[model samples]
Each structure stands twice: as structure tokens, then as C-alpha cells.
Target: MSPPKETNNKINTAKSSDGTIVKAGPIVKREKVILHIDGDAFFVGVEIAKNPKLRGLPVVTGEERGIVSALSYEAKALGITRGMPIFRVKREFPKVKILPGDYHSYVEYSTKMFDIVRRYVDDVEEYSIDECFGELTGLDKPLGMSYRQIAERIKKEVNEELDLSVSIGLAPTKVLAKVASNWVKPNGLTVIESALAVDFLQKVPIKKIWGIGPRTAELLNRKDIMTAKDFYDKDIAWIKLILSKPYETIWQELHGISVMEIDSAPKTVYSSVQKTRSFHPSTNDKTFLWSQLSKHIEDSCRKARHFNLVPRKFSIFLKTKDFEFVTALILLPSPSNSPEILLPLAHAHFENIHKKGVLYRTTGVTLLDLMADFVPQDDLFGSNAQASKFETIHKQIDLLEEKFGKIVIYLGSTKNAIDHKAQDGGTDSEDLDKNLLFL
Candidate 1:
């Protein structure tokens, strides 16, 4: 853009801590040190990080059910994406090395990179395993350098440690930084002046901004609003009519708004949550449903833990091949560590939703009525005389798992999926929380 911003007049010189001269790009006027790093072809990058041999070769990972979880740039250049069928990926990129998703590897890289980032910024938000946002507030210590200085260091650090490249985008607002980061991708930094954000976005297509997907772009296109600038200073009612959903946020982002209003406060309400499984279809045995639920419970709790929130009640819901749906939420005395205690609770709900002889193709478990963990609630006493002892054992199990590892514990009833994975030790999915991987 603008002849890549001329810098031929300035002589650049530096050592890369390796006694090597660093060739520099043009001098850019960077305003805010809001750094965004997005790992290029992330899951594939992880595969290469773990086994360098996987580099250069096209690699695709997912399940035998034929879903593409992640693709190397080589595969992507051939037109593959997250949910494309694996069979087509194979047919298209025949040279590609197809493997089941190594989610664990992705998790490790995600954790390690952030551990490094936390050293520099106080507010580092992990948006996903492959992307993150960092904010630089004080001009106090490394206080003197331009915003570009911080972004360059971050880019170099991540590349060196992760053996992968990440594009950095810098600006005043999160939205602008996010857009700038995407400007020059696959290992580059692009910074837009805070003042010029509106003008800059006008030159870029509407689809370039986040949240505006294909469907949104098509709608905007029909209205002759093809770029971010097209939406700027436009009638609010027109945008509301056009967007239909998330209109306000879309308008603000287009105007260079930094704070993510919805995420800024981070709602704690556990309105409802659902997890689904795409099975092999061969193993539709009614019993296999428990494995899916165990995974769902584990994942839901992890999300609950992340928000520092917990649920006082749980609900189990299911869908069948016939298109029927059913759900139930069992109230618990106190918030539990996970829904492992809710196996029976889920079972009770299922009994109500279960339709006999209905060949169910898909199923889900939902948890709702969430409350902050601090809120007190009563226990669900059992019918047996040893009910008190049962409750104590359950609490003890949670403590042990919390102190040691989740594998250091087990629940007899829901042990099917949980135990199998733990006993096998580490698979690619092991990198994610057991529940998340399973879900």
C-alpha cells in the first residue's frame, strides 16, 4: 500500500543476537503496540515443529470419518480448509501425508508461546490455540522504543522458539491491529496509523474484516457496500437492517473501536451449552453414547473453569435420526468439579428423552443454569444408606485429580472413554483437555 512506505533514506543496521546483520524494512509510523500473532498454517506447523520432516510436504490431519482438521500451506494452496472432507484432500493433494489430528501438539505450542508472551504484556488474551492478542500499556521500561520495536521483537521471539512464523499486526485498537496483522501475512508485520484506520479500511474489502463471512459479504455486496469504508459514517439504521446480527459491534470495529464490548466484561451466565460427536456411524451402539457424554462433561467443565464460573445444575439433551430432541438439567447441591457426578444425573434426564427403537444418528449433552462457584447450593442426597460415604468419596476423587492428574482418578460408571484414553497415555488429542479433544 502507498508504495510500501518508502524508507530508502534511512540506513538500517542491527545484529540478530547471532552476529548477523539484520536487513530492515521501510520505517513505519506505528502508533500502538497492540501486537497480534497468528501462527501460519498452525496445526501443520505443529506437526513440523514436532517432526521437522513433516515440513514442506503437504500434510492433513483429522479422523477416518474424513474431516480435515488442519492443513499445511501446501495443502491450503491446493484449496483445503478446516472442515473439508479428507477423501477429497487425498484425491486433490495426493502427495499429502494424511494423519489423524495431533491436537496435543497444537496444544503444546499454544501453551509454550503464551508462556513466553506473558513475560512482556500484562494483558495477553489467548483467542485460540494459534492466535493471541497482546497489549502494551506503559512507556516506562522499554519505554522509549516505537510501537514497531515491540512488534519486531515479538515476531522474532516467536519464530525462533516455535520454529514457526507468525504475522504481527499493530495499531491502537484490537480491531485495527487484527486487520493490520492480516495485511501482510505468512511472516510479516503491518502497522496502520491510528488516525488513518478509517481511510485504510475503505481500501480493503468488507470480507477482510473479521466477523464478515461469505454470507455477510454477499449481502453487503448487494447493497453496493463492498469495503469497510463503505460502512463508515453510514446510517446506523441501514447497518442494522443490513447486518441483522452483531450490527453494532460491526459498526464500531469498522470505526476502529478497540475494546471488544461483549468480551470486555465476559458474561458468566451458563445460559446453555451443547457438545456433539460425529461418530464412525458403525458404532451407534446405545452404550457408546456414554463415552460422548463423558467427553462433553469434561469439556464443559474446562470452559466453566476458564470463566471462573461453575454450574449448580446440569442438563443432558439428545437428538435422533428422526429429528426429535430431548433435554434435562439436574440441580446439584454444590458446584462439582465436573459432570462425572452427573452420569446418573444425565441418565435420569435421558430416561425422560429416550424414545425406544429410534435409530439416533447424532446426540448432545447440555449444561445450564450456571452460577459463580462462590454461590452456595445443597447436595443431592442418595437413596442408599451409604449416600453420605458416596458423596465424600466423590469429593476426594476431585481433590486427588486436582492435586495430581485427572488420570490419577476415575469414575466406575463413566470409565469407558476416560480410562481408555488415560491408559493409552498420550495420543495427539491428549494435548487438548480430554473433554475438548473428545468433544
Candidate 2:
């Protein structure tokens, strides 16, 4: 049986004990100006930055994963897309150039881009490797430039110093800023004032709203809410009742009300840390499979330590050639981030899930239930001393790696995975350090 649609009967007015009608306080509106800066094909842009000759040519990255991770606008003009198999691209688009991903260079460029933004605006949110949101409210008079002029200056500086193209959007809120940034492609600048937001939102489909997924878009379509303006036109109480809090926040932003604040703080705590690697040519050799899993554990633990965190539980998984996952979760006796402590437990569980002659293509480990490693807590069995000793050793190892590069001193178990050459003649795996630590 179909259930009845939930209804909201709440109103803005209320009755006091004295039977007097009372109305809610007047709505307070705040003025906010946000800018979203997005890179145009960031990974490919970095490659072109290194060698200007690659510009105006069809180029792609992700040679390591045998898939198209990022492609230039020129390549996109030929109908190539992200996640398309490299083999297919070579066969169909013979002239398209494919390059291995230089994640280190990408991270360097990303840092420089955000740093440049911070020089203009102190409140900057590093949204991703290629995207960021900056607050520019009330800075017009002090900075001696309008919001649009500030955005243009930022874009110009980034282009001149980094030799990369960026699209920028200036709007009243982050959601609106994102929409404006994406309005034009490659290198574009768009501004959406609060007064004219409806005009801009009228042309935006519900699916185009940030954080709205396909399923939500389908549901909204069934309700005859087709565009951003349609969604914004709904009653606030009705939206709160029908959708989740996040969507309600988006609805508020669509109306040019600054409901979401810009988070400019650095991320230090995490609930979980995960590291995974997918290699070419599925292998059935038990030793090699264990080596891959070991590397994942080492990488995850390294990140946990960098954040001064330790995990009390973890899970290991292996992906078969047919794309099936076999996983095992293990709870530790105590929270720890030492590879010496995790390797033994992971290997024992790996044996239980490792099927004979079953080829596997990926291996991963996830550290869960993390907490600050301020003080070592000893279990009833009293293993704190041993754990402390390993902690000290890892601190030194981390120092060496920081000075040199990652994996300066890895566990012997990861030797096989580290030494093995890439069968596809690409990178062995993505550098976890560069991919994870962006601060």
C-alpha cells in the first residue's frame, strides 16, 4: 500500500497562555558575498603548465589506473570523458595524448591557488583539490575594489603566476557562487547579485543544484519542481518537512539567504582513514596480494599518526577480477596506529578471505573509530609499553619520510608491492601522502 504524504501544520504565529495572538520575530537577512574558484581541467592544466607545448592539444591523465582521470577541454571537444577506459581512447582517438598523473605537481598547484586566494580574503574554504570558496563581504571599501573586481584580480593573478586558467563565480552565497562559476566553461567569470538571483536560478535545473543527487532530482521532478527557482518558491516549512536539513539549507541559499557559513578552519580530526590501490592484471599469488594489503595498512596508519589519531578497529578488503569485494573487519584490543601491531592481525584475517586461485585486482585497508593519541591507554593485558616503543620508532620514521619522500622505511611485508613494476607501463599507485595531506 502507498503511504500518505507527510504534511506540516506548523505556522509562524502562536498563542500565549493569556489567549493573546503572538507572531514570530521578523526575519533577519544578512548580506554575504562568496566567490567560488574552479580550475579548468586541473590535472591536465598542471601538465600544460610544466610544458607549454601541451597546450591547445588533446591530453588526458590517469595512465596509472588505465582510465581517464582528467582531460583537457580540447580532449573533451572530441567527446572524451573522465573514467573512460584508456584502451578505448587509444583505439578510437588515436591522436589523443595520455599522460600519467603527477599528483605531487597537482597538489603543489592546488596549494598555490588557494594560497593566492587567501592573500585577498582571509575566510577561504579549500573545498577540494581544484575548487575553493572565499568570503568577500564588507571588503569593498577597505580593499578599494568591488566584489566583481576582486574576483577578476584573483583570476588574473592565478593565470599569470600559475599559467593556468580558472573560472570564477561571484554571488551572495556559496551555492549560488558554485552555480555562477559553472555557468561558462573553460575560462569564464559570472556574477549573480541577490536581486537578480531568481533570473539566474530560473534557468538552472533542480539536478544542477549542488548536493542534489539523481534520486532527489527525480523526486523533485515528480513534485513538479523542475528548476532552482521552482524549489526556492516552495514554503520554508513545507521544505523542512519534506526534505532533509541539508536540502533545506540549499533552499535557503537559493533564495540568497546565507544559511551556510564559510568554514575556514583546517581539518585535524577524522572518524576514519582509508587507503586503497587498484593494480593492473589481477593476480592470484597469495604473497603478492598480502603485500598489497600490507601497503594499504602502512599508508593508512601513516596518515592517522600524522593527525595524531589512532584507530580501535579496521577492515581489509580485496576486489576480485569480476569486481566482487571480499572483506573482513577486525576490532583491536586497544586503539593503536602502529603497523607492527596491525600487520599481524590483518594477515591472519587475510588468510580467511583469500580464496585459492581467485584473481584479485584491488586491495584496501580502512582505519575506523579513531581518536586523539594524546595518552596511551593500556589494556588489562598491559601492552602499553610495547605500543609506546613502536610509536617512538614511527615518529622518527615519519621525520625521515617528511625530509625525503614517502615510504623511506616501510614494513618488509610491503616490499613486494613496492618493488613490483606496473604491468601497464604506468605509475604503480597513487601517492597516498600527496593525495591525502593538503594542508
Candidate 3:
């Protein structure tokens, strides 16, 4: 890949609110305000928000033998860590609440959180289900408050409205904002102003810098850059020689420069998409196993369509109760995300891997070698032309499902998986009404 375009080294001056002339490198730096908001122990917080009695008690989320997905601060204080199995937690902290994850409620709270942030800043990036970044650079005059004050108010409003604790960080760059936010936890607020940027860097390890993973951290350690301050103190010429363009941008951001902007749009491209699920009891029923694979394919296709992408290859795998895997891979007749074209191929390949009397516990499907949905492909004719018809019908079905709810209209083959999910405590109340239609 080509290297990132180099920026000039010219310095520029700007007037601060105090009318003091401030100088910055490369780009003319104004008071570039970026705020990051992170929900504290998100899934556990949601459970606590739903049931106030759970407050101050050790709470964890995950069920059906899955590892711990989330834990409350109280649970953390009690020496409970994430990814610890539920059965062990039961054996250890028997009083902790280990409820099944309510994904629907989590999504609801996430939407509410984003809605609250949007009220204050138009440029809001939903970084994750529990994190968001909002731009407040030019809003100080109109909002009648400083950037720090705006961040403080947002934290207060989220707490009062959602009853969930959130830690917030304000900085001139997105990377610094993320660092500041993580520095404080359980409803703390931190600000990394340009004047105080070096102080913050000096206190953090190089590994703690946003975007610096273990491999990069080790590389920097070899150069004796143990702290964020050490990395920041590197010469620009050496940084360009040692690190890639992305690292160079982070280096600049550490110095209180805004090289990265908040991206608010949903991701439209992916290298691959996968869906998987395990049922309560293992089954050897061939039809039931195929149904599960069908459902996974349908779900993967749905996500591909949401991103306007198409896959050229698809694969399926089934895990046996004895901890053995049966897998198959096939190149598609055409690069497509329409379930109609892909499901038949999935079933055809499954035939090669299905072993009689081998009870399977889980099934999964992955769409790979993805490309833009609109990319040109070989012209369809006769039997191949039917794919176009299927595409149009599935597009309509997608819109209807988006409006009404998923499974309101679905493939007949997936009905068995839906029924199995309902019987095994997988389907929630919202899905029950429409799933009954298939019966």
C-alpha cells in the first residue's frame, strides 16, 4: 500500500479566548474540542438500571454456560474479572447476579445514550455500544459554556436521565480524549488541555496510548520509549522513519494536535461476516442441524446487505458433541449476499460434512472475500437471471423486517432453528409473536 501523504511543517498562530496568540505546528490549531463518553461496566450497569435493587450488589451478565460478558464495579471490587465462567462464579461468589444477557435492552440503552449526546453536538460518533465521541469545538459561544463545562453537563444529564454512570474525557484530539476518558473510571471526568498534554502523557505507559497494541508497544520499548512522554519526545524525522502513517498520526495527536476526525457513519465495508450459535442440548437430527446452518447463513447475508457488500465465498462448520468439527467451503456461483442464492450452496456443501449419528452442538456460517455490492459481475442469463428476482424480493423483505421486526417474514427452512431457539430459552418475548406465524 502507498504511504500516507506527508503534511507540511509550517507553523500557524491562533488567538485564544484570552486574546493570547498561541502557535501550533503543521496546521493552524484552534481550540479543537473532542469529548469521549464511556459507560461504566455497560452490561452490568444496564441490569442495575433495570432493577435498582441490584445496585451496590455484585452483578455479572452472561448465561447458558457462557463466560462472563460484563460485571458491575461491585463485582470487580469483589475480585470478579471478565471472561470467568458462570459456573465458577457461582462456585465462588454465589451471591452475584448472573442473569442472561438482555441484548434488546442493551440496544435500547445504547440508542438513548446516543440520542442524549446528539442533543449537545451534531458530530457524534457512536464508537461502540457503550462509548461515543462528540465534537464541541465551535459550540462554546452558542452553548454558553466552556468545552469542559459542556462535558460536565453531558455526564450529569446521562446519569440523571439513564441512571447509568459514565466517565468522560475532553481533549483537542480523539486519541487524547480516549486516554483521558479511560484514566478516570466510575463517573470521573478528565480534561487534557494543550498546556497540560505533556503532563498526561508522562503519566501513561506507551502501551496505554490509544492504537498502540502489544506488538507496537514492544517495538517502541526496544527504542526505550517506555512512557507516552518518551514516544512524544521522539524526533519527527525518526518517527517518520520507524513508524507507519497511522502511528505518525497518533504521535501528532499526543502533542495536542487534531489529525483524526470523528467518523459518524456506519461502516459500509468488511473483509468478512460471520454468525454462530450453540443450542442447549446437542442433536444428531440432520434436518435440525441444516436448519441451524440455514439460520446462520440468513443472518450473515442480512448483515452483508446492511453494509451494501457481497461475498464471493461462503463456508459452514458444525461442532460435534465430542468436540470434533465438520466443515465445508465453497465458492459461490456468483458474488452475492442474497440468501436465496447462498442457502442452496450452503446445504449442498453441508452434505459433504454431515456425519450420521454424530451429535452436533453448534453451527456457524461465514461470508468471505467481500466486495462492494455495486461492483460489476458476469451477466446473469436464464437460470442465473433468477438471482436478480430473488434480490428484489429479499430487498423488500429486508425493509419490512426493519420496520416491523426480524422474523416477521423469513425462510421456511429457518423455522426449525427459530422454534428450537424459542424452546431452548433463546428467543425473547418480542420474537415469540412473529415466530408463531411460521408454525
Q: Give lDDT: candidate 2, residue 429.
A: 41
Give the per-residue lDDT digits (tens) of candidate 2, residues 103-222: 999999999999999889999988899999999987776899866678878998999999999988878889999998887666777777666678778999999999999999999999
Candidate 1, residues 1-439: lDDT per residue as tens digits?
3343333445454433324343333334332346777888787788788889988887888855478887787877777788988878777777878887777778898888877766666678888788888876444246466556766777788788889778777666677778877766677677665455675787789887787888888888888888888877687787776566676676766565554621322235556655665443423455666666766776676567546566667776666765566666678765653554566677666666666666666567666676665523334454322434444554565565677654343344444655445554544434333334121
State residue 245's C-alpha deviation in candidate 3, in Å: 3.5
Which candidate number maximizes lDDT? 2
Q: What value of lDDT does candidate 3 attain over all alpha carbons?
A: 0.82
Order of the predicted models by TM-score, top scorer first = 2, 3, 1
**TM-score of predicted model 2?**
0.85
Candidate 2 residue-pair clash tally:
0
TM-score of 1: 0.74
Residue-pair clashes per candidate:
5, 0, 0
Angstrom error of the Cα, residue 16, model 3: value is 22
Tell me, by TM-score, which candidate is best: 2
Give the C-alpha lDDT of model 1: 0.65
Cand. 3 TM to true fold: 0.78
TM-score of each model, paired residue for residue: 0.74, 0.85, 0.78
